[model samples]
Target: MSDPILRLEGIHTDIAQYHILHGVDLEVPRGAVTMLLGRNGVGKTTTLRTVIGHWQARAGRILFDGAEITGAKTPDRARMGIGYVPEDMGIFSDLTVEENMTLAAATGPLDPARRDRIFEAFPPLRTFWRSPAGTLSGGQKQMLTIARAMAEERRLYLIDEPTKGLAPAIVSTMAGALRDLKRQGASILLVEQNFAVAKALGDYAAVMDDGRIVWAGEMQELATDAGLQERLMGLSMEAQ
Candidate 1:
């Protein structure tokens, strides 16, 4: 791969006593989407968290753009133009939809043009503009989290399972929004379970098993070869 926006070399991460990631070497090409595919509980989320500095890596080098961010604090990582959309859909339930977006603005008031763009990408956020975040459905909440991350211009985004349990229509909407983000030149490292969606959006793909990257190549190659898909992703993974 060319010079990537984000790179992890020999990453090892432990959550308390349980070891999760073992030597996770990966790269997210600039201005493109890289799908991290794996079965349930195979350290996909752990990898994204490690990149965002949510969980400190036991050992490894994490480079964002060109600088080492292996030891940077989570807040510092956020400040340095990295946006994270976790699996949990981090949001303030008590806050209104508008409030949540305003908070994500961070530096100052939300920009008018950016807010409009977010609303265009996710119309539900506009519908529930003044409603508390808790009032929205699961898909809407997912949209909100993604919208929050898109509220500002970031160099890269770390998104985990944006379509986990969403309706097909909502999933389509989410996919379109992600495509727009790619068009806008934001590098995204996405952990997605829906292989169809992954194939549609990804330029490159990495398959993880037992905390290590087992397969990596262009998404087109993985999409076209069923044998490779079965060999790398397996029936166990697709069943999930």
Candidate 2:
């Protein structure tokens, strides 16, 4: 197999003396979708933030496309083809959908072909192209956020909970968009809490507990191993 597009080894992070990520290790292979699963506060978001250089890691190393990026600045990483969409979706309420996308395109030249491809994958965004991002529904804003990242033509995309707080219908739509991105040969590192959604879209899955990965394997294997899911992800049918 080719070297991974992104990898984190022994990543330890501190948020003003409060340790968050504890020796977290993960990888997103080139052109594949990797899911990071964990309960709330288990460092999944922190891991993505650290990888994007928002929260500097106190220890360990992060590599992107075979170059060490542990110390890379946030803007430097963005220029190196890493795009991040946080749980809040990160869309500017004051900006129109098109404006938000144009801002993200600042990272790289916008390819008309790719822009059309993104629109083809997410027709809703095209419909709301002139509307303010804040005026859109939760799902529409989420699509715009991910679409903005796509506009950058980045090699890897880190998305935190793209499906959170949306209707089931919209979640399924976003899932299809993710599949389109995968088909376009873009690598994705998804931090998602919905087990069903994660298992549906991710090729590989890692379960994190207490800031440490407790299990990592093919998505099918993780989905089938109910015992491991319960132990690592705190999943239960009764709760669902």
TM-score of each: 0.97, 0.94
Q: Which tens-of-lDDT digit does each residue in 23-44 have in candidate 2?
A: 9988788998999987889898
Q: What is the Cα-based TM-score of model 2?
A: 0.94
Q: Which TM-score value belongs to model 1? A: 0.97
Clash totals, every prediction: 0, 0
* Candidate 2 runs further than 4 Å off: 107-109, 237-240
* lDDT per model vs. reference: 0.93, 0.86
> RMSD per prediction, one decimal?
1.4, 1.7
lDDT of 1 by residue, 60-151 (tens): 89999999999999989998999999999989999999999999999899999999999899999999999999999999999999999988
